[model samples]
Target: MRTLVFLGLLAGFGFGQGPQATLPNLVPQVVSPPDFPPELAELEGLHDAGRYREVYEKALARKDAWGYVLASYAATNYARYQASDKERQDWFRRAADAAREAVKLAPGQKGTPSLNASVEAKAYFALGQALGRYVQYAGLFTQALLVNQIRSAFSKAIELAPDFPDPKIGMALWHAEGVARNICLIFGCRRDQVQVFLNAAEAQRSNSKRVILGYVDGGYANLLINDLKEAERGLTTALSLTPKTAEDYYEQERAKGLMEELKRRKGGSR
Candidate 1:
């Protein structure tokens, strides 16, 4: 999972709001079904075993929509751990291409029921992540241009799986970082949009009973929006939750770092 590390900074703050207001305790309504195909499962196993190249190769061999999405995910991870910028760019582009292919073959586009809603949602989520990675490497002009695409892809994923927490996190980050980077360019973007998405993400995360990324993401968004109290609460919640995967552990570390930063900032203010 790509971390929105760019949003970690508190610089160039805009769109000021008052102290974070308390959000009502919302029960999460989303339930993600185990919808991965056998082939995809095999790819995941290989990926979990740190066999990225094999996962990529097997995923490519499958030559299906899900395969492409899985391949994109594997490629993205391979790129993530690499040291070279050129390699990262190449792999991210490959991941983006595969995700695009998956979208084209996704069901319910032209009223085709070939693929189920869950499958289609996964593809859109993958595409959103791929686009986000691309945005990280892109120049300011290019990043500005791709923000809408990122938001749209994640929105489609949410439309497909309202209960899924990942897309909501993605959407929240999109709003938070988009506003932070260039508020004028975002269409119909509101300063409160970040809080809205964060609330949704927290609800989804609670409802889904899955990963811990939601808390980490929400905490990071709060940090970006200068909601220190909320940031602390969110990250602390994330730390208390059990991580479900290596990715979750990675996010936990990030949350810890952010918590430390928050402490530093608070102490400085005092």
Candidate 2:
């Protein structure tokens, strides 16, 4: 299957597309988002050479309008480095903000409503993902807070463009937002607070590739909640739906790890 063209669709998701874009033959000049000023090929070379940290740093420098694209690239690597919450959150927040800026700047003189709408969807979704990552590591309360942000991103992502793969949406709302809020309620999240983001993520089940990534993330969230059965199911499904593109290798490694863990648990039980 042709891997979906995922990057530029959102931020903080690590759908890196360095040279893939066809700079228009006719379009207004706009500076690329602020971020690490590395060419994609150089970054790719770094990644290929196993210099992941360098690649991440390179991406982190891109903090302009299309910053999310680079930030997402950075965060994807940061997650692997066992970064501290403060460290990673700072990066994620920066990336999300940059992505949002890209959306605002995306509307050039020639931009149609359709294009603007798509840009908004990507920006919001990227912000939500970045915030969600921060919330997850902060604590139960943080998780609860992040749920609302996640839903908000997905909600906007859907409202602007509601025609993504079904599983993508499912992960965002049904799994990421829904399960987190409900679980957080047991901790301290307010009822109304939970409803806002939960409803939004739930309302759309076809937001984007996020639905699938959400499921994968949802499984990890389940682990955070200590729901082994659910974690098993979620991770299993996540592995199944996970894409195999070079961009998806990080997730693929994670899914494989989850499978191994689940199997270990099952074997232990037996």
Candidate 3:
């Protein structure tokens, strides 16, 4: 599948390029916006209750940008957590397709203020996230195209809303994964920028589970670089957060798993 080439494309296209900043050692205190759409909030509640299939069905019924975006999140979570191996690929494809539709329906960011243009940012982020999950099982012939699409989606998301942290986190993960796979040897993956992106994201605190994921991804990036101290710090911060959604719970569990791995590595270094 020429994964090295794919990483090269991701770097050349400026996937992880963003503002540089230092992430504070503590999780930022933030609150969810009170003006959040009630209907979407209800779906998020259902998703938090772990009723992913229900949320997916209900969100899909709305047949709009917001609906499709939520549906994509639910679908991806269900596929990752509940779907059988045989079903995972199809579910991921469905998730990606739903997110793509959301992107199409979302208003363009041309004249819209970044904060007011969240729909397009969310839609593009979901599209990138879903395509990333799908690529794991996609055929080699399609994987290249999917990789490029994922990069484009996330890049557009960050461009549409520079303050949005999820896309920034996604970009950090892209660089971390490239470094983990030694793709930096091929394309100058710029592993240092991994922290740069994460730092920029952390500075924009939010109540969304995406912020928690930023920590998880940061821990993962540090883990990839064998920076155990920072890795443990990041994972610990992720674990300290209250899970506000099913995805948060899922990722915290992942954090725990990573912590165990970190411990093992630490012991091995003795």
Candidate 4:
């Protein structure tokens, strides 16, 4: 049953289904679903060799059909990394369209709502994440809208699946806080909100999560309430538990960066 579930997930590619589109970003290789596809080895053979784009096109090249649409939807991550900022949203929009269509192809209430909701939920989340990237890369200077969108997407994700501990939202909140701080620098808004968001991130994942920045999140979170000892404790824990491979690096780096920030602030305070 587990193997069947894994196969089911991998068969769809990444998420949705459709023609041909773009990606949101480099889909971190670490976050694969529990249930993957049987032919994953085959598809992976193509993707790992950097032929995923070619294979994707070939799979969908034959017709303007459902599978084709689905393929595009699944391949959005690839497209996101390959395209310019303006083009990334195109990929997500395409996935959203394709996912909306998947409702019809699915079985009765069971499959239909599940497929459609999952599709839409992810599309919305990806759309938000891509927009976050756009603000940073495209020189949009629109932190207000970007943060709002990100918060909305995360709220929707929780609404869809309250049990989910979405890492994307964790990362998004971090980025959103950064944007807010930078954008509000002129107006002299509260800087503490940045720490607030980061704390929420840590609280959400500290036990089961890794420090993307090495020791910074722990360093800062522990220090924020004047918990320097606890901060060091948490960060030190992260350093020991941190994975040597995969997405753990992001957390490691995050912790490292936060510690640096703390030191800088301490120096400034002195």
In terms of TM-score, which candidate is strongest? 3
Q: Write the per-residue lDDT of candidate 3 for residues 94-165, one digit (tens) a residue.
A: 899999898898884222322454778889989998887787676654665666677788889999878777
The TM-score-based order of candidates, best leading, equals: 3, 1, 2, 4
Go through the candidates in order and give each one's C-alpha lDDT.
Answer: 0.65, 0.45, 0.71, 0.41
Clashing residue pairs in candidate 3, if any?
A: none
**Sliding window of 10 residues with minimal summed lDDT for model 4:** 10-19
What digit string (tens of lDDT, one per residue) describes model 2 on residues 1-270? 111222111223221111111111222111222112234445544443334455556655654433444455455445433345456656555555555665565444122121233444555655655555555444443444555566666566657655433223323333433333344333233334323433344354343323444455545545534456766876776667634233234455566676676677767877
Worst window of 10 by summed lDDT in candidate 1 = 14-23
> In terms of lDDT, which candidate is strongest?
3
Mind giving the per-residue lDDT tens digits that candidate 1 earns over 103-222? 887774322121244667878988887777776666655665576788899999989877777777787777776566655343445558888888877665544433566787778777
Q: Given candidate 3, what's the lDDT at residue 266?
A: 97
Candidate 2 is scored at a TM of: 0.51
The predicted structure with the larger TM-score, 3 or 4, is 3
Cα RMSD of all models vs. native, in order, equals: 9.2, 12.4, 7.6, 13.4
Provide the lDDT at 221 for model 3. 77
Off by more than 4 A, model 2: 1-70, 76-86, 103-117, 137-146, 165-215, 218-244, 264-270
